[model samples]
Target: MSAAREHVIADLRERISLLEGGSARKVGCLPFGVPEIDAVLPEGGLAYGALHEFAGGGSGAIDGAAAALFAAGIAARTKGHVVWCLTRPDLFFPALVQAGLHHNRVVFVEADKEEDVLASMEEALSYGGLGAVVGELVRLPMVASRRLQLAAEKTGTMGIVVRRWRRQTEASDFGQPTASTTRWRVSVMPSDELPVPGVGRARWFLELMRSRAGECAEFVVGACDDKGRVDLPSGSADRSNTSGRSVYSR
Candidate 1:
């Protein structure tokens, strides 16, 4: 083979190898606050290198605090640092610490604009050392989300986008079309009574909205401990209505 031809072939081979490696590469897992939710996910936790959207019904009504705490709990459990980007400057840090996220493990960034939040989140995810990146954004354009997804994939880090309920609904309605491997919606449920009873137990509904592997189901999980880690709620009967939807009545 001519020297130039040999060089071209070698370059082509290297490109092919990279493509294969990327496909086979596994992303890190962000363990959900709930064990059952983690079990349902393919990786036994939130898959890394992908976009995971948490959709809620309305602003301030979507349980953003609980959701943030949940993500924080995962970061704490994994002993990984969390880069939290929020538009609202008032994040309940004490509550987050109570939810199992250590104050030292979290780095809070308050972004004034949605674009800045996304940009900062992408940078955190790409920094390659953090366990997970959590961003509270109102809306994420498809193109921007795709870029963030690619960045996550490159670093093998988990990216979570918490969409405010009052923002553009299309981002959650049409599935945002990012490189995310899975999507989930979390809502607060009435807590089961505890024997000691201070705040009682915390309950939540975890709905797997979308998944690349295609097995999606709704599960009820209860939070335990001072840090609010979740587990299967005992004595709670599984009730499925005629429409095949699981309903938990308070």
Candidate 2:
């Protein structure tokens, strides 16, 4: 806790951030590429070497898929390979590819239960040179999430927990803390209709439920494309009114 000692530690953190390339939001941080959104996040963006949680708004099928796709897009933004652990085989690679997470860069592990999934994710995160490790869970206890966080920190890998609840009641577990760096609740929104009468791009209602270093915020963004980028809605010519963005706090 000495002043000089603290300064030395800070310098070392900054140096590490620089070595990571574009992950220099503050320290262990990278911009989400959304100006307004990044402005409010700690380090001005999501942090590396930490655990983040994503969940659906309800028990709806599309809601869970939206959360997974959102995490995939974030992972796509990072470098190296991605390991996603899930109990179910419902994930379709073609949709992930459209979200910028190319099929080749990803490795999927199918487990029969949550314990296996968590174990696999922790192992993947411990490995060096991986971009990210994702674990799908219906209920993540604080103890489990903390272990994952510590593992990710050991090597600077990112950990994303995609909470996929099998029942509406199970999702209630999300109300508790997991000591994660950040948490988000994603909901599907009606896509914009083209003049030709068909779907445009997918849209999402992103709720920033928890931020260790930021205030809670909400946004409606166009789903990630082939390059892992989130954008304002195509119809949003102006955002003086947030283009329909909202924020909530607890």
Candidate 3:
């Protein structure tokens, strides 16, 4: 090969490598306030401009609700606007507000079917300026997920997938391979035991099942509040009253 031609070929190879590495790029992150998770995540927190999947550990409404709220909290962290596509209209606005995603900043798009929700998510991601695009789907195949991933990279928008299934059998679909940058299983954990006879803050097990350039880890933190912020882990709390935002009802 001629020297000039060889140099051109090497440059082309470098560009292809950069494109391939984009899947695991540390675009940006939203901190969780817990050191354990932050220590393991790339770029200090959850990365934006990539698709992250979250599914409930079990096949029930409570589990599904927890997973949805988990994703909502992340959506609340996005800049500009948030677009949410769902097959059902059950997202309680008040609960979302508590998680920091306000009604005014969020645009909810209701779809008749899960397939439609996925389609909307991809389309919404294509247009720039939105902080994030979230979709609730029962099953997201690898091909569909790759399209969403590519769209996020092109536009620098976060993509979140909340996996909630109508049938118990369909819950198994979460195990299928996907092109998502991260995969998580969020489930409700027992709330902290209050010293007084009153309910305590809701807790969740945020398990990182897959990360392209990070560790598979788990975090148990106080669930998100009205501003979409999670408290430091209860074990780390010096006192129950230490956290100012103690109103925890979901």
Candidate 4:
């Protein structure tokens, strides 16, 4: 190889070593607002430089909008740019904003086919300096996922894969083809009644299917406010106090 080429390769290797070493150092965690769930994740939040796979729930168990909102809320709270690549262009931004994702931080890229979606997602992941990249596609090949994982690692960003329910068969069979640090399944839970009239709390069941750090478990989390941010349901004592305050004020 030419001297210039050798020099370039050496420089690249040094950069990779720095990144790998820095990844081991603890960066502050970004809370998802779900205490129980966060407790299980490394760094007490989603790990950076890793792939996170979201398994599709059974029919009617979960909807894509709800899942998008859930993930979007996390991205919003982390205060980073999010690239949402989807095969469908019909994303409900209003709902996403309601889920606490700032419209300005989100960029929606629609693809005509699943292949295009994967291609776009890979590109977005490679661009670097993003908070998170979310891809909603039918089926993601294991090789493609591995490439994305490497890109995310180089950028120190998070990658979220939202597989369609119809493709659950293949996705589940393939598992997470990359060296993703974690995998989770999110499903909508029955809404809880709010103290106020005409309002209800959004609930979800988060199943940690795979984690590099530990065993998997299921937890329940509820979304409060119009933004759909997840948190643990209030205790009875807290609820009673809230009710008393409302009554006294009235």
- In candidate 2, the residue pairs with backbone N, CA or C atoms under 3 Å apart (3 or more residues apart, or in different chains) clash, namely none
The digit string of per-residue lDDT tens for model 4 on 128-148 reads 667788988656677888888
Scored by lDDT, the top model is 2
Question: How big is the positional error of residue 140 in model 3, measured in Å on the Cα after superposition?
Answer: 0.3
Off by over 4 Å in 1: 1-36, 57-62, 167-176, 195-198, 224-228, 237-250
lDDT of 2 at 165: 78
Q: Name model 4 segments beyond 4 Å from true.
A: 1-28, 167-178, 195-197, 224-228, 234-250
Model 1, CA-based lDDT: 0.66
Cα deviation of 201, candidate 4, in Å: 1.0
Candidate that scores best on TM-score? 2
| lDDT (CA) per prediction | 0.66, 0.81, 0.79, 0.66
Instruction: For model 3, give the 10-residue run with minimal summed lDDT.
Output: 239-248
Over the stretch 148-246, how does candidate 1's per-residue lDDT look in tens digits? 898888877778887654444443443556556776666676666668855556666667878877579787776434554678787653322111111
Root mean square deviation (Cα) for candidate 4:
9.1
lDDT of 2 at 241: 17
Clashes of each: 1, 0, 7, 1
TM-scores, all candidates, are 0.73, 0.82, 0.81, 0.74
What TM-score quantifies how close candidate 2 is to the native fold?
0.82
Model 4 pairs in collision: 98-227
lDDT string for model 2 (1-250, tens) is: 9999999999998777656643332126757789988977977888988999998777766778888888989999988889989888778777788779998899999999999999999888776567889999988888989989988887788899998877888988999878799999988776655789766777788899999968999998887888888887754423221121111111
Quote the RMSD, in angstroms, for model 1.
Answer: 9.0
